[model samples]
Target chain A: MQHSDYVELTSTRLNPHVDPALTVWGWEVPVYLFMGGLVAGLLFLYSVVVLLRREERYPTVAKTVPLLATPLLGIGLFFLFLDLEFKAHVFRFYTSFQFYSPMSWGSWILLVVFGVGGVQFLYTLAELEPFRKTAIGKWSVWGLFKKISGNTRRKLAWWTLILGIALGIYTGLLLASLTARPMWNSALVGPMFLISGLSAGTALTMLLARARAERDILVRFDLLLVFMELAVILMWVGAMAHGSEAGLEAAHQILGGAYTAVFWSLVVVAGLIVPAVLEVQSLRGKWPHTVVAPALILVGGLVLRLVMVQAGQSFGYGA
Target chain B: MTRTAHKYGMVVDTIACVGCSACTLACRSENEVPEGLSRRWVNQETRGSFPDLKMKIWSESCQHCENAPCVKNCPTGASFIDDFTGTVQVERDLCTGCKACMASCPYDARYIHPTGYVDKCTLCHHRITGGLETACETVCPTSAIVVGDLNDPGSEISQLLRKRKFEQRRTAAGTRPKFFLLV
Candidate 1:
């Protein structure tokens, strides 16, 4: 295989050099992150309603959540499945537990969330004493499960809360674990995703709350979460700016570079700040009951995920 | 009798390169790598003023890092450094095509196959298992690329690595890369 003479190059076009992985992961990943956050956030709220015994005051959220949370989680898992290049090998995610990989943490957390969330949904159904004695309930194990009583439900609610928090943080840690992408390298990313998840969850529940008191309370909490979300985003950027060049490079793209316009206008202004102003006006009775703010919050949460993934990929750490 | 542990590594003599693309051809043919993607690539980086122009050739691929961020970051055990030779290898059947390893690697060495698995330079593990040198190292026209077990004091790579000044790729990334560019 040795050649003594210098070999001459022919065509350079055959092996064209390209930038490394600025577009490796695309839209599907962000969508999955958003949905996962939403599920975690929603279930956390559901746990609050059940464990805190606030179900009487927020019956709309309490009743609907058991039904809503699991399916939303399923949809999020579906998006995760869609992103996998090996669709048939989806079962591999469950085959082992890898502590080093954040993706491993996510798979296990997501499964636990689904399991606890599904059980909670069933328990909520069985708790209905009137429905349990009915023909529909006795058709299956619902009648026997109805005898499970309040103690099991409480245990499940506690499990749900723990797993919910894990799942929420895992969404951000998933990307933050990628040290190669300096944009995502931060200890604060988990809290950032958690706060966003809370805000998005509040907004999602507000959309379904039919009671006057429930909507009003959610609006107040949603506004608080939105404020916290904005603050965390600023803190994240500031911390990155103070530390390393790679972080700054990533921060530059998101804060002032190619993504500046869309991120600020679509994500910050229309999605967050404007909606916050609208929510404040409604709280002061300047405007009537409206879905605009809550809707905007959800959109902003999704934009956060999308922008992070896109700009983070565009950023780099190696030559 | 047991096979002795070997930390196989490579040193590329950048000064001797002729931009031949011969190593790339050898890698492709040996590994049966798909088109439009490669386990290795050649790039040119030019520096200095117009009057003192100089160009450097970078035949880039997986660094086969000692710490191996890709191995740690891979959810499955598919991307692992071989226990016998201590060179990285991928289990194609075990890979789920999640691209976690690909994203985690700083070198950008891995790519997804059409059948939905990640592939990257293994330093020709198939041939090395039978006591053969890597195809790229064997076919180099200028004898620019050298490979051997760094742990063995008698090996060619160790001797070259000790006498020559070399720079590692992305050493600051904390990956502790094994691939070296002999200056």
Candidate 2:
């Protein structure tokens, strides 16, 4: 058999940030994603608790978690701003709305979240004894909230729920919409991030809830979310495996490539599986309820974003 | 038949290229592209075994696609298609430097300029709009690079593409790139 060996030598003025792979988005992006996902989970869970009329049973979730949404989202936005090369031009995002751009959609969605979430936060604060005595809390806005009917508040809760879901999915869709990067091109990324966000939110709620019943219910919900997240992760990888050449290579990136160990150990096992197992045991009364499970879940959720953002940038069609 | 807008494009005669990188240098000198960054670059590909060999060299840059993903994905209206020339150009003032356009570009043609804006090949819009050839085209020793309005049937680029066999890079990306490489 005759053998034919092929070699190609090419050289160009290399742009380090773009050439072999796009490394433009750094730690700031992942941090922003993690924070955004956390807030999304908090908003979704708070809205659900309100809609179910379970606020009495889950007072901490109803009152405390809603207060954290705006602050956490603010932190996320700050990190996102830091990642911008032209920091002064950040306002340009709001100047014109490009319908096809996910970042545009995200900026707008976040604005709505802040507005509705702000109202929700103020209402929660007005009810609290510490806030009622505060100088700013004595303002007329609390009186305005007082006149808002229960039905109208429920409608507000519905908006919060929808916005929460949108914010969660938007975090993933931001990357998924970019077809240039094969790893993030899958539609499953949206649902995956949403589920993970929900799990993180539930875990945080469990950690803060002083009532035993609240923690018990949240533990079960977090377990279910963990399972859903695992399924979505499988579907995300499976879809990539069965996709085009670039996509298959993208799947390999986390399956056994550079991201494999961190992805499996930090994100899957430590983040999802272990927390799930502990929560199940706690439900069975075989394990003592501790902060370990929820803490693991929060860490896992952060690691998931870090891995996805970094790994997605490590490969592309050009790379 | 009515005359339409000028659809600017480029055709590179790979056969005639000598891998001298004169085009890349000329482009840098003319554009004042910042240090360690370029709007265009040269590629040299060699294939086959020691017994038989084939080499192809060509200058490459942004395709200025009719369906540019950068334009579609830019959160701000910074990256846009020029109406008159039908070329992809950036509005520096509107760019947020979010790097979304860079991530969306399959050609890896865009880079963050030192002035903190995403920049890429404009197809020498500044020169071509004034009825002049691009810096690279003017300096090509072998006359390997041809830039013209593809909408004009008699233009050199259109005529060359019609007469010779050519290939566009990453056509599957659905960018509908105008940069053609003659095989």
Candidate 3:
């Protein structure tokens, strides 16, 4: 075939492998990063409970949230390995240090978070077991409770929570530093991710609070956080829309492409509006609607992550 | 001994690129790039319709910038260049495939190779050091692609670049890339 006049015929044969990548970032990477970001945010907010609230009221959660969060972050890293073509090659990150690479920094940060968080969690659980005994142990088992929550476990929990929050926010900063992707280039991304983590963490905390605290408290706090989360998301989307042309194009692709339905339905209606109304009702002592709001908000927050990860891919040049 | 320095690059005439991807294929054979991998590519733009249809092509590869971002951001020093010769090379053994270099590059030229190492065009450093031209330039049917040291005033690349107007991608990114497009 005759080559076009305006285009270059710069090689002997036509290249056969010129198609666009099919599964932009694949399922594992997007899901894993989202999970990691959420875990980071959640762990940070949980620390606030430890540092701010009275020891008697917040100790149960402050002691327990790290136990849950540390594991999720660990699992998130496992999913990250799935994105690699050669999974074992990831180990090289530790053997050789590269200060300029974000991945190298991110991996190290994750490792520290997990290591410190995991030990602290186990320590706090052991400390709690002593209190679980006596009349409390009469309901449970005295020996088992004693073994899980022993003495000397006090300071570890606070340290773990503090480190976890710092690590989580750093993860958000890593993604924001990449200027190549206009969609991710905004200064808003790091803070947005931090807020997202708070939303997810609090949603999970509220779910747990339903069992531990009064239904009234759970319903009120959960609904309020849901409203705040939704507002953050809207601000994020609006800022993206008004940014650079490339950024706007990226946002439109999110609105119209694969992420559209999830953004509008799950994040907006399910995560925010519905929850806000139900929470308002809960504040007014309307009990029945409160249950529905938190559950929907949980599901909606998850959908928000799926949409954000998948949305980044749609910005690729099809040609 | 005086150091022998070379800064390799390409001069593509955007007006002559047909989007046939011939340069891409030549690079694969010359460099033995894996089946699903490529060292060069052409971006196609289609506009208008029917009899008034028009398409433009922008051929791309590693721009080999004077201020290469990949070299700057590589964490393990896996992605580096010869300070004397200016030939950027990747040390596969050291690469962690963290995809950090991929993000730092303004042109999106770098990628995680199948071997979990970073991969991209290296300007055929081996062949050119043997006093041969780049595969893309040697095989170009229309002679649309050129490669040489921009520092060499007598080189064809330097002459053509000096004689005609040229453009580089993402000028605002301030890469000062060696590659130029005669648009």
Give the residue spans of candidate 1 off by over 4 A: A1-21, A126-138, B1-4
Over the stretch B91-111, how does candidate 2's per-residue lDDT look in tens digits? 999998999988888788999
Indicate the worst ten consecutive residues by lDDT in candidate 3 chain A.
A13-22
lDDT, candidate 1, A213-287, per-residue tens: 988898898888788878888888889887776777778886779988878887788778988899889889999
Looking at candidate 1 chain A, the ten consecutive residues that score lowest on lDDT are A9-18
DockQ for candidate 3, please give it.
0.29
Compare candidates 1 and 2 on DockQ and give the better one: 2
Tens digits of lDDT, candidate 2, A1-319: 1356466657685986986667999999989988888899999988898899888888988889988988889988999999999999998988999988988999999999998888887777777888889899899878877556343668888998999999999899888888788889888998999898888888888889888888898998898899999999988898999999888888898889999999999999999899889999999999999999999999999999999988997787742
Model 1, C-alpha of B16: deviation from truth (Å): 0.9
* Native-to-model Cα distance after best TM-score fit, residue B60 in candidate 1, in Å: 1.6
Summarize candidate 3's per-residue lDDT along A1-319 as a digit string, tens digits: 2333233223221222112322235566656766776676556655555456544665435656666787788777787777665566677767766565556676777777777676655555545656446464345444453454343234544665666565545555665555555566566666666656666666666666534443455455556556566676677778878976666777885678666877888878877788778777666765554346667766776666566555653353221
Query: Which 10 consecutive residues of model 1 chain B have the lowest summed lDDT?
Result: B45-54
- What TM-score does the predicted chain A of each candidate obtain versus native chain A? 0.89, 0.94, 0.76
lDDT (Cα, tens digit) per residue for candidate 1, span B1-183: 113388888888889877788888889999998887788778665555555666667576788888887888888777887888888888876688888887777666777777888888999888887889899989998988888898899998999988999998766567878899987
Better of 1 and 2 by lDDT: 2
Which docking class does model 1 fall in? acceptable
* Candidate achieving the largest TM-score: 2
Candidate 3: stretches off by over 4 Å: A1-18, A21-24, A96-100, A128-162, A210-228, A288-291, A317-319, B1-7, B15-22, B43-58, B65-77, B81-88, B100-112, B129-131, B151-155, B170-177
